[model samples]
Target: MDIEYIKDNYIFEKLNENHNLDDFECEIEDLAKFLKEDAWNQQNMNLSLTHVVICDGIVVGYVSILTDAMKLRILEDKETKDKICSKLNISENNVIPAIKIGRFAIDKRYAHNGLGKHVFRNVMLSILDISENIVGLRFITVDAYATAFGFYVEKHKFKYLKKDQKDVDSLNKIIKIDPERSFSLYKDIKSILK
Candidate 1:
């Protein structure tokens, strides 16, 4: 089966009071907790907005997004910074604006299936549309968890801005347990258009 057919069985919407979020469980406890708890709180606070993917009137997965900025000077890879500047038509030392996926999770029942990718494809499309029309977004960033690092980098082509840098989205606080892992990654929105 292809991703389209799998995606066709699901419906995507912004998180709302009408959502059936009681039984939404993923492998990660924090992710599951966020969906049922922090998602609404964060949304109401204007900190982040969650997008849910539902099937059979039940929430299957979700991704929360928030605005972020990537500092070119902080990136370790000079080549990547140069490419970003050249592609976005900006200076190498400028801070580029971006959208960040603050959290992403798939329900346990939906895990190991292709629904995550399906949901991600739609996200890319939505962000791409927004960037082209409503806003001039240059990148889609994510502070991906250490466990799912390979999936984002290999499957979605998200690249690390710097291997040694701490997670910037943590807002000046340190929550990371592993200093060796660089989970802050980004995908150029322009690259998706191409």
Candidate 2:
């Protein structure tokens, strides 16, 4: 599979409408299931920025950024909201500047080729570039999966905003990645062209 960055609205719409879990491998199927649910769609409907990772010209993974103030507050928990605002040195009522990596999933077939890292790097670069355009953007964040926490911390150097906790004794674990601390992981982005 060839890796390419996709930003077409029509392509993203078609991918979102036609995505199926059955076509991917088991690991990817799990990720797709979460992404395909109504809850996920509804929660991210207000996001204004989106980027899709295409392999062989087919959409396989995506990442989105939300700049909407109301939507940001609605998507975060009280504690997270406070921490985020504080970290960025913004008041509660102030328009909070944030970039959220809403969804990231790689096709099972392409998973073995380090596509996850590729997509993640591309997404980070996209966010950083967007940050330059939006002066208010002070932080980039992501709600990383518990299973992938170790990778984010050890491999990517993403500092944990809070301790790891199990919400329902399930595979899902809620954790945040602070892009400020993990900025070094993106040196490669500077070398690669968009």
Candidate 3:
């Protein structure tokens, strides 16, 4: 699997093939709704740093990072946010930099190819690279879907904070996975970089 960071609209459009949302019974309209009002935003454009995974040049899975503080605040609560800040060791005056992973859809055909791990590793690499240059980055956060929470916690080692029951209820009503929460898996990028 090849993970490429593509900014082109065409690449973003290709995420529909064997889309992850479809696995969760989410439709394009639902995605549009989230993007319109719920998705992250930064500097006017959606606050999504997207990564596309290709098998033989075909887009299979994709992941996005929400780096906008305002948008993140709207999604997570004050306590959860403070925990993330503590993990990153940032002062209150500094802008809270976070990495929210979304759109982690893998093509149904490529389910067993380990593409998910590849996509995650690439995203972490990018986040680490960016955090090295930035001053106030404290934590990498995700409101991981219930289906994906185990993978995030067990495989990725992200510590679960409090859950946003309201958001969890609104999104996955029947799944009955624990309520969605904020998690900070990687706290210090600078030390790792050095």
lDDT of every predicted structure (CA atoms): 0.79, 0.47, 0.49
lDDT of 2: 0.47
> Using TM-score as the measure, which candidate wins?
1
TM-score for each predicted model, relative to the true structure: 0.83, 0.55, 0.53
Segments of candidate 2 deviating more than 4 angstroms = 2-22, 25-30, 39-44, 47-50, 67-96, 162-194
Instruction: List model 3 lDDT by residue over 76-157, tens digit each.
Output: 3466556645776754445555655655656555454565665566566777777777545646666665656556666665
Better of 1 and 3 by lDDT: 1
Model 3 clash pairs are 41-47, 88-138
Candidate with the larger TM-score of 2 and 3: 2
Tens-digit lDDT track of model 2 for 137-180: 64455655555555554555454432222331332323233211
Report lDDT (Cα) of residue 60, candidate 1: 78
lDDT of 3 at 90: 59
TM match of model 2 to true structure: 0.55
